[model samples]
Target: MNVTTGLFYVFSAVLLFAAFRVITARNPVHAALYLVLTFFQAAMIWMLLKAEFLSITLVLVYVGAVMVLFLFVVMMMDINVENLRVGFWKHFPLAAIVGVVIALEMAAVLMGGFRVVDDPNAVAAAAEANNAKELGKLLFTQYLVQLEVAAAILLVAMIAAIALTLRARKDSKYVSPGDQVRVRSADRMTVVKMDATQAAVAPVAEVSEPKA
Candidate 1:
């Protein structure tokens, strides 16, 4: 009916289509791309809901970083499409049922239309307020220890990933930092000091020609 409602419907439609494609697409790369589209649509919806901080974070973290990583991983992976599709028809009914259930649940939730207007002025004031700053304050004050723990966990995970990547491989050559730091020119190379003398030529023996 209204412009906001129209935009919501449009974004919702595109989001649903993209989400469906993410599962149905044969190619993993295409699926990842579709998932990116889904994330973008969800971010748009968050923006419309006036959750600017969440919307921007969703776009930056998920669309920019996570989806890019997913695309890279999907593209790099050697997937056998035929093997993947082998059980598609066999599993289609169950997948369709689950999908239908999720759709119904979402439809039920969205039946309560958008625009919560308990107080328009309050909503406008809240919208004008700095949500990112408020969120940061809450994180630092209310859930500081939890936030720190999460950060520590993420750091550990990152370290574990790097450690796994640095594991020794028989086929791969890795330069050790200590070895590089301790390397000497003398150990790496030896300059030969040979004189540039002309090579000696042997005298040719002249054979006496026999009378033919």
Candidate 2:
């Protein structure tokens, strides 16, 4: 086999292994780390495909930023692995069926993609072209509506997350900026004035001698 094909097989093998470990790892942090490995492997495969921009973006965005955040969150969370596994066996059958169906669907799509023939000249031209510029052109022209829709969905999701996080809770305390800005000193403190009173003095009883 050629060097490039051999490298592709090696990367794909590692990627699949890492992806499996991502789901099967007992510790959340370990699972996240495995996922990061999967991303790196996928990025390497993209590099072999000559999509340098996509490969670097996959590394920078997912491996560097997203996976780091995921690791931090996983590490910080107090996850009870045993408790999480309690229902795993109970739900395994249904989950397996769904997973199989999804895998079949993906296989069909990939098989179709593999059957498509590409022109060598066009592939060479595309390889020589600026990846980011071409991607931008496609996003703005052919996929403009789809891109805008995706952005709008992301915006809505962000707003929804903020709303959920900031929602008032009876068990939690929060302050309103408007209330703080409009607060008056008089409302916060009150002083009562009273005349000073002298200290009470105890009366002294004259010592009665034994009357003797």
Candidate 3:
């Protein structure tokens, strides 16, 4: 009925549509673009919830940086789409079941959240306070260990991903910085001493004045 509620419904619909497209789109680049749209819609919803910091962060970090990198990677990689879809039908049932379970869990959590009542004064205080400042306080104070653990886990995951994807190819050329730093000019170039040889002269038969 209200403009805010109308906007929320519109954004939620777009977010759901974009999210579906992200998973179902055939082209990886198109999927990534759809995911970016999904993030943007989610960010808009967060803005409507008055979480400005989260909204901006989602836009800047996910849409601006992460999605751009993902798009570039998808574009650059030689992915076989047909090969990827080979077992789609075989996996569809299990995937659908898992998706349904997750959706149910999320719905339960959201329903619980809706049922919980918040103090009006506390809500007003929270709304008045700086979002980023309050978030930082909570992160550093109560959830510091958890935050550190999450960061460590993310770092480990990044390292593992790099390790798994990295391959030593025999055909690919790579220069070792240590070897380069330790290289010597003498090792790089060699001068061979050799005797200078004269050019060979071929004997020519003299033509006797064109046989008058």
Candidate 4:
């Protein structure tokens, strides 16, 4: 009917399609690409809803950095696709049951929810101000500890990932950058003074050549 509603439905459809493809696609790289698409669609929807901070964060953090890294990691991994899909049919019933349970739980929770009245004036007011400022206030004032905890968890996870990936292989020829940086010219090159003495001396010519 309205432009916003039309855009919402279009974005929602694309988001759903991308999400489905992420789960159904056999190729891991394709799945990651679809997931990036999903994040982009979700970010657009959030932008439409006036959550600019969250929308930008979604696009920048998830689609830009995280998904790109995930795609690289997925591409690098030696995964066996045939073995991964070995029992899809066997797990169908169980998967369906879990899906149904989640749907029912969401339904039950939503059914108990109270709907807000449409405020035309509030919409105009919201348009005049940035939502991110309010969100920042709420985050810093009310949810600082929770946000800190989440950040701390993320930091720890990052450190753990780096630690897990790093290995000191004795067989591998690796150079320590710190050690390399500390090296002086003497460590890399040697100056032999005997080389100057060994340099060919111009043979003295006869008096005739000197006169010429």
lDDT of 3 by residue, 1-212 (tens): 99999999999999999988877788888899999999999999999988999999999999899999988888999999988778777987898899999999999989877644478897788668888898999999999999999999999999999999999999999999999999999999999998869877889998777665
lDDT, model 1: 0.91
What is the TM-score of each predicted model, taking all chains together?
0.77, 0.72, 0.74, 0.75
Off by over 4 Å in 2: 87-101, 115-120, 168-212
For model 4, the run of ten residues with the poorest summed lDDT = 191-200
lDDT of each: 0.91, 0.88, 0.91, 0.89
Model 3 clash tally, residue pairs: 0
Model 2 clashes, total count: 0
- Model 4, runs deviating above 4 Å: 107-114, 118-127, 174-212
Clashes found in each candidate (C-alpha, N, C closer than 3 A): 0, 0, 0, 0
Candidate numbers, best TM-score first, in rank order: 1, 4, 3, 2
lDDT, residue 9, candidate 3:
99
lDDT tens digits, residues 1-212, model 1?
A: 99999999999999999998988898888888899999999999988987889999999999889989888887888889878888887898998999899989998899877656799899888878887889999999999999999999999999999998976779997888999999998999998999869978989999999999
In model 3, which runs have C-alpha deviations exceeding 4 angstroms?
86-101, 115-120, 183-193, 199-212
